[model samples]
Target chain A: MQDTVLIVGAGPAGLSAAAQVAGVGYKAVLVEKEDVLGGAPILSGYARLVPSGEWARDAIGRMVKRVEDDGNVTIHKGARVTQLNGEAGRFTAKLSNGKSVKAGAVVLATGFTHFDSVNKPEWGFGTFPDVVTTTQVEQMVTAGKIACPSDGRTPERVAILLCVGSRDRQIGREWCSKVCCTVSANLAMEIKELSPKTQVFIYYMDIRTFGLYEDRFYWKSQEEFRTKFVKARIAEVTAAPDGRLLLKGEDTLVKRPIVIPFDLVVHAVGMDPNMDNPEIAKVFGVGLEKHGFIERGEHYTNTCGTTRPGIYSCGAAYGPETIDDSISQGMAAGARAIADLHGLTRKAS
Target chain B: MAIHEKSLIEPERLLRHDNLVVDGVDVSGHWNTMITPRTITDYDDDFEAVIQRYPGAENVHRCWQCGSCTNSCTMYAQNVQFNPRYWIYAVRTGLKDEIIKDKDIIWQCVSCNKCTSICPKDVRPEGVMKALAHWLEDEGHMPKSPSRIFDEEFTEQIYARGRIEDSLVLLNFLKKTGQPLVPQWLRVFGVRLMQYLPVGLGMRFARNFFIPPRTRSWGRTGEVLRQYVREQKEATHG
Candidate 1:
């Protein structure tokens, strides 16, 4: 039998895993829930990367095309793995489309969900006409239009609420949506470029400009885009009669109750594991972390494969992660799966 | 794939700055900033009492001021000095006055819950924040702020209506906070319209709100919570 690797969730992680497996002369079966797959980054559209600053559509399009044309790769659209069984070097996955595939290894690259802003009703996500999530803003940006969702008119003052559902303990979401700080900063700059007339205000606690992009992006956004970074948590978002949004927050540095009015409000919503992960974990006989992310062993041993041997997982399926990190992990998982298959073959001898 | 090379600090390095007294180490005039001669108070008694009250608050001591908690905090993205990690460190070591000095920020948390989720150890950061809030109030360092007033109003409103009444809560919150109404009549009217809907419709509008809703033993829930609190206290104390 030909050794095959099954990659689930065709986001950056899954695609990367498929590409890596193909490079190593192994067949990679890539499955995705949506017809198109770039995960949240693709969905949010503003992949306006610095350096070249290509929109997500173009960047992801090139990546997907590369993986699709690979002879060793099989792309399955509108397909989700409903079941995962067996151990490392030999496993089987049952898909929602009723196709059962036996594989030597499985890689789970399931990504994250946008934390529901409605939970923090004070931020006025569902209630306020102007309040929207980062995902919605991505759609607007992708359309080459930057207008208030509440009213189609161009917004003069815009407030972006950071850490909506992430980093909150009230509703039991305690993990930092790792990407929010960077994404918010990037989006704030993008919005400014899109609408020079719009004054952008970021209501934040501490601006995390970590890694290579940390303070570099922060300083650039501040000096270039003039994004007003505030040190205060917004208490609530209330709407006025004219449909403008009211943001109530404490300007902690100044120790004053600052009430700012804005024409548009974008919630820098954090990431959470997709809801179906728990069921998926049970089916695969794999353990998940408290946050419902796949549990990995030691950083090296648990690079991609789960505690259950023959079952490897990667990407956001573990938790909130970035596109680049997911791709790296996907490659790691592919290498691990191939090694396991090699080990299985050696053991038979 | 071009992998970004990240330097992983050793796990022990995570606790580098934790629990060390600055003996004769004057941070004064370093980095062009004058370090004030400060008296760091050891409110060990108060800290013990706080740990006694909220027994689970011991995790506050486990913090190493690594900025990880603050970095992970939703509020940290908003307020830099409202650093939960630093505040928890101050609280753990009985730096009561320093903690009280930052009391205004105690209410800034929306409890989006990212910090606790990302905490490598199960440190309940929100719980620690609440404990600090309680301690600040108990110590009488600051007067009743909007959040406290809001809490009182919420309790009274919920007690009276058997559920939270949004219109009343807002009105009472505003009335107590002494903030001028931006559009007083319109807000009231709009809320009234919201409330005028049938109970079913109202519940759908504000799921937690109820006017004539059925009441199930608030007394029982309170007692259960109290008992749970007591058990936690005893466990921690033991």
Candidate 2:
């Protein structure tokens, strides 16, 4: 009998894993909680197909079609694996809306959730109409316009707050949330392109432009777009009478308080593990860290696999990751799961 | 096939059930290092102790080795092991010996207050790290480096003169720490020249260097601190 692999989530990681499993002949059943496949990336509307921004619609369309047409693969939309039982080689899953399935192995590509901007109320996410999140900006860009949420007018000036919840010890998230700097830089460029008249300002503690992501977008914004890169953490956001927002932050480099008024404020919120992963861990009989990511085994041998046998996880399920890293991790996890299933077959034989 | 075997093969029942036992226990002494008590001395002088203290650092006992603080640290991106989280965990569990091992790092903090700012449970990871450095220094575990000489000389100067004279402190630190005085000479000359700069050019910096650190208005902050130190010593050894 052909072994079956159940993949939870339909984001980049999930779709990538499903493609690998189907290629190797194990029946791949991909489940998604959302009505569509792409998850938050689709919601945010960023076309994060690697090698510097290709059309995500085309990429996702191809992957979705391939998974749908594959003889050994099944796609379940608006369905979630509510419960998981048993272990490697023979596992059972309970799906939402009262369906059940059995699988030889499980892959949890349940990705991360964006840290809520409202957690630090000082930034005035919901309190002020102009202060929006990176996700909101992505949606506006996807809709072919960059209009301020409050007035629906082209904002004359925009301020992007980097590390809103990320790298903030007060908010209890200290990690860099790696992708924020790149995403913020990219978004700043996107905003400048979308609305050329609007001056963009990125308020940051420090510009962490690491890897190939270094200096390219940052310099482009500063030199070409004339984006103001402020070395300061925003202290408070207060509303002005004329609907403009006032931002107060200490320019630590200069050691003075900088009060800037902006028409729009975009909070470059950080990423944290998916909200549901903790309950999922309980369902799967696996361990989760205190921060609530599925515990991985020795990172070398089991980079994408969990501490439990036969259960694998990849991408933002561990922490924040870019779309490229997520896809790569999905491929690695798929290969591992395939090897595991084949190993089981040999043992039985 | 038998019904029982069929039930075993059923996908829903086979995977979602967990029957493992996980009873919680105080697993503090599980580490081999905790098996024996390690004896060490506490803070050497009252002057050093005052600088080490931060209000509301007693919650250092609540760290659960979560590694969240370290992983979340912005500083961790630069260096993974320079973790306030682990240091806090060590301090919380009374793992003084382990914390003292990190004496060199305790002083390297940039004091951006980022760790304390982001703590989830208000663990004040930055404050705890400061407390750890203080505890280690109290225990005579401070690294005998240039920073130490700076601290010693800075303290000695304040005691000698009512207020700090930067020239004297720097000279003393260089003399004691064996740092070449040539660098000090260059810095002193540079500072003298800097003092003549235009308004708001180097005024703030010059003011900081020349003016001593402000103390309480009662003129008894130093005296009170000294008395407290003497009492602590008596209570410990009496």
Candidate 1 regions with alpha-carbon error over 4 angstroms: A47-52, B1-238
**Clashes per candidate (backbone, < 3 Å):** 30, 20
Off by over 4 Å in 2: A47-51, B1-238
- Candidate 1 has a TM-score of 0.59
Chain B only: TM-score of model 2: 0.43
Give DockQ for candidates 1 onward, in order.
0.01, 0.01
Q: Report the lDDT tens digits of candidate 2 across residue range A200-239.
A: 7788877776777765766555545556565678889998
User: For model 1, what is the alpha-carbon lDDT of residue A43?
Assistant: 58
Candidate 1 residues A145-244, lDDT tens each? 7887655899887788888888888988888877777777787888888898787777887666568666556656654665666667988888666677
Per model, kept true contacts as a fraction are 0.00, 0.00
